[model samples]
Structure formats: structure tokens, C-alpha cells
Target: MHTELDFAFRRDGETVRSGGLVYATVSAEGRAAIALPARLVEMLGEVRSIRPSR
Candidate 1:
């Protein structure tokens, strides 16, 4: 899966962005595997569950 690069300037005028491509591949044992940037992994840790409001 791929996500479009999205970013915005913070109040402090610093840009914050998060977007990356997810790759699908087979593992050494013939199992499905995924890989991504370490920075993206770190960002994932900060993710929170959210509900869409109408």
C-alpha cells in the first residue's frame, strides 16, 4: 500500500510530515512479510485510536 506524502507547518513554523510506502514480500520461511522505515515505525508508536465524527 502507498500513501500520499502529506505535511503541514506547525505553529512554530516547523514542518511535520508522515507518509511512506509499505512493501509486501515473502520471508525467508516463505511467509508474508512487511518492511518500512525505522522513522515510520517510531511514528506508529505514537498513533492513537480515533473515531470519525459526523
Candidate 2:
């Protein structure tokens, strides 16, 4: 059996953003940066009620 894992960063018991950041292409360079809403990041272990997709 094989599973594709989606990994996240967990440090001292919290989920920290750990990924490559893509820099925005400036409008001067003919593009604009997107604004994203801030969100809370936390890692509270695994969910026992979850199942694999069929």
C-alpha cells in the first residue's frame, strides 16, 4: 500500500509555515502581488475520524 503525504511543519507543537515562497512579479515588471487573508496555523495531532479517499 502506498500513500501520498502532504507534509506540514510542526515546531514545539505548532504548525509553522515552511515552504518555498514565490515572490510577486511587480507591476513595473507587468504584474501585481495578490493579497491573501491571514489565518491561524496550528497542529493538533491527527484526526481519528478521517479516512482515505476511495
Candidate 3:
């Protein structure tokens, strides 16, 4: 499975976002709580997937 982590820079009226990719063995655990590999983090930067609030 895969997850897309985006970084949204804070702004007064506009949103700026950047994306990074990460992987997982399963999606059942949900992307929020998944732990990525340290090597991957070092190589690809930090990954944080965000979902819209319900």
C-alpha cells in the first residue's frame, strides 16, 4: 500500500502544498498511525498523510 504526505505552508489567504510518498504493508491500520522506515525518511523526507475533518 501507499500513502501521500503533503505539507501545507501556512498563509494568510492562500495554501501552498508539497507532496512526498511513503509505503506500508497494510492499509487496515490506517495511514495516520503507520510507522515508516528511518532510511526511507532520511531518503525521502518526512511523510504525513492528512485527511479532511468530518
Candidate 4:
């Protein structure tokens, strides 16, 4: 299922800001974490594709 997730920006391992994302998957379960803004979750209906930004 797809859902908006909240998170915070982090300079180190600790979370300094709140930011995350709930991406939709084809499989029932998977191992991976997607980071995104909660406000933009709705904009992404389904996780069509993912690529490394850097």
C-alpha cells in the first residue's frame, strides 16, 4: 500500500528533520526504505521507478 510518511532531516545518523515516504509496491513485502516529503507523497501515486539522485 501507498501512504505518506513523516520524517526530519539528519546531519548525522540522528534525525534532525522529519521526512519520509510510503511507496506502493507490487509485492506484498520488500526490503527497502524510501525517503521523501509527506506533502509530496500524494503527488506520487505509485512508485513507478526509483533511481539514485547522486
Candidate 5:
């Protein structure tokens, strides 16, 4: 089976903004970062959740 995963980062001391949907490859080792916002580091602390496509 195949699944779609998404990642979003929220930095500390800053408003947690939606980083938007990201395309990742799912495998036994887990999902890998294929493409994501460059601002991920800015919102590393404010990351609310990594919602996966159901």
C-alpha cells in the first residue's frame, strides 16, 4: 500500500503559520522529506502536528 505524508514547521517566539502541504515518500524507515518550505527552521518549535493524508 501507498500513503501520502505532509510536514509543517512552527518556530518558537513566532506565530505558528501553516507551512503548507509537502510531498514525502513513505517507507519502512518512515517518510522522507522530498519537498518543503524553506521556513521550516523558523518554525521548528511551533510545529503543531504533521498531518498525514487519509
Candidate 6:
């Protein structure tokens, strides 16, 4: 399963929003958090999600 993260950048009364994706895997121990590359812009209001997709 994966979780979707969203983020936004605002500057000079302008806003640009983007999304980041994270992944999870179930193993014998428990759910493991997977690390992925996320794309982020300047003036981040909140860290929702920031990842590049192929």
C-alpha cells in the first residue's frame, strides 16, 4: 500500500501545488516505510507530498 502526500508553494500571491508518493510494504515484522525521491519547491506552506514519477 502507498500513501499520497501533497504540498504547496506560495509566493507573491501565487501558489503552486504538487503531490508526493510514499510506499509501504508488509513484512514479517510489520509495515515498513519506504523512502522515495520527492520534488519540492520554494516557500513551502506545508509538506504534504513531493515526489517525481516515471
Best by lDDT: 3
Candidate 6, residues 1-54: lDDT per residue as tens digits?
Answer: 444556657788676665454444454567664433243222333544344554
The ten-residue window of minimal lDDT in model 2 covers: 36-45
Candidate 5, residues 7-52, lDDT tens digits: the string is: 4456885546544544333455666533444454344445455554
After superposition, the stretches of candidate 3 with alpha carbons farther than 4 Å from their true spots are 25-54
Candidate 3 Cα RMSD (Å): 7.6
TM-score of each: 0.22, 0.23, 0.28, 0.24, 0.23, 0.33
Once superposed on the true structure, which residue ranges of model 6 sit more than 4 Å away at CA?
A: 29-54
Question: How do the residues 13-49 of candidate 2 rate in per-residue lDDT, one tens digit apiece?
Answer: 8867543322222334545544321221123234232
Identify the candidate with maximal TM-score: 6
Poorest stretch of ten by lDDT in candidate 5: 1-10
Give residue 21's error in model 4 in angstroms: 7.7
- In candidate 2, how many Å is residue 45 off? 17
In the predicted model 6, the residue pairs found to clash are 5-48, 5-49, 6-48, 6-49, 20-49, 20-50, 38-50, 39-50
Greater TM-score among 4 and 5 belongs to 4
Per-residue lDDT for 6 in model 1?
A: 32
**Which scores higher on lDDT, 1 or 4?**
4
The best-first sequence of candidates by TM-score reads: 6, 3, 4, 2, 5, 1
- Model 3 earns a TM-score of 0.28
**What are the lDDT scores of the predictions, listed in order?**
0.44, 0.37, 0.54, 0.52, 0.45, 0.48
What's model 1's lDDT at 31? Answer: 62
Candidate 5 vs candidate 6: the lDDT winner is 6
Ten residues in sequence with the least summed lDDT for candidate 1 = 1-10
Candidate 5: residue pairs that collide: 10-43, 10-46, 11-43
In candidate 5 the C-alpha lDDT for residue 23 amounts to: 38
